[model samples]
Target: MNKDIYFEDVNIGDSIPTLVKEPVTKLQFVKYAGASGDFNPLHTDDDIGKMAGIGGVIAHGMLIMGFVGQAVTNWIPKKNLKKLNVRFAGMTKPGDTISVTGKVVDKNAENNIITCEVFAKDQNEQVKIQGSFEAKLPKKN
Candidate 1:
């Protein structure tokens, strides 16, 4: 899908298209917990979440990070990417819509790599994840 992107075709400040994800829910948290082997009650039990200071169960921060990763990979093929990192900044509730976006931050031609900065936001425009990505672009003939 990213066959169109070549090393010489991208530049700093170029905006990658946005990727939208479905809302988070309790079931999703439970499933993710089981899938990831992370059974932290704070992410699946409302009572424990409230007692921990957060009013309700919060989605796993890694899940939001995954969404951001999905955005970058969606724009550029997987093997093209070499590095990606995300920081969970805000809590996501059941009804929140997550949108992931990124921009070309720098190009490292000597190493055949391009760097990108990414973030995930909710419907309120509040940033939920702050992240960065680095990728290897195909060389031009």
Candidate 2:
């Protein structure tokens, strides 16, 4: 694990470490479905996905969002995260590699809080998720 980031350690506009994940896979979809209890056929069954007119199976949006969350927690501890908001912008299919990145957009020393703008994009540069998060970091004594 990385050392804890204090409130004074980061500056507005600083870039967080980028997180690039392996290509989405059918087995991963199945595992995510089992863990999230979302057995929507579109995520696991190609036939159902075709029937839904999505061409083929698409990954769960929440799974992509989880990737975004992972990027944030990679930079700061999980306990520091106070708020996370995201919107699904595009579908992610099996075989698509997703990359999550963020920039620190705001910082509040009074509350030791920092806000970041975050995004997840496919290898083709298509946006899959857009979001923001707030983290209250510890202050140096």
Candidate 3:
């Protein structure tokens, strides 16, 4: 669960707690597709994915991004988030266990803004997404 974090309590280079998610599954993809309205066969149909030369059905990039978001929020509250950006690095396939990790990269005491660099990688250490986020944290009195 995310707890309130103060700007003074964090420092540049400090590591955020890691979030390891269970292996990806087709069922989860289906649910995500329904919720996201993506309905892209490449993410839900093995045959179409294979035909597209991606081997087989792969998890949606946004789903993996959501995992990264979860990791960030696990460290700080969503209300504090100011900016988030990500680049899709690799495909996430079924049975791939993803682990999201991050570290504080910069901090501005005047603005109470903290910047963090984060990445989501599979069990093999294959990077699925890379990103950074900025959050305005409260300063302890």
Tell me how far the alpha carbon of residue 123 in candidate 2 is from the true structure, in angstroms, after superposition: 0.4
Better of 1 and 2 by lDDT: 2
- lDDT (Cα atoms) of all candidates against the true structure: 0.88, 0.94, 0.95
Worst ten in a row by lDDT for model 1: 1-10
Model 2: runs farther than 4 Å from truth?
A: none
Q: Write the per-residue lDDT of candidate 1 for residues 43-103, one digit (tens) a residue.
A: 9999998999889899888888878877887889998889888888999987899999889
lDDT per residue for candidate 2 within 21-136, as digits (tens), equals 99999999999999999999899999999999999999999999989988888888998899999999999999999999989999998899999999999999999999999999
Worst 10 residues of 3 by lDDT: 1-10
lDDT comparing candidate 1 with the true structure: 0.88
Q: How far is candidate 1 from the true structure (C-alpha RMSD, Å)?
A: 1.2
* lDDT value, residue 12 of candidate 1: 95
User: Please, what is the TM-score per model?
Assistant: 0.94, 0.97, 0.97
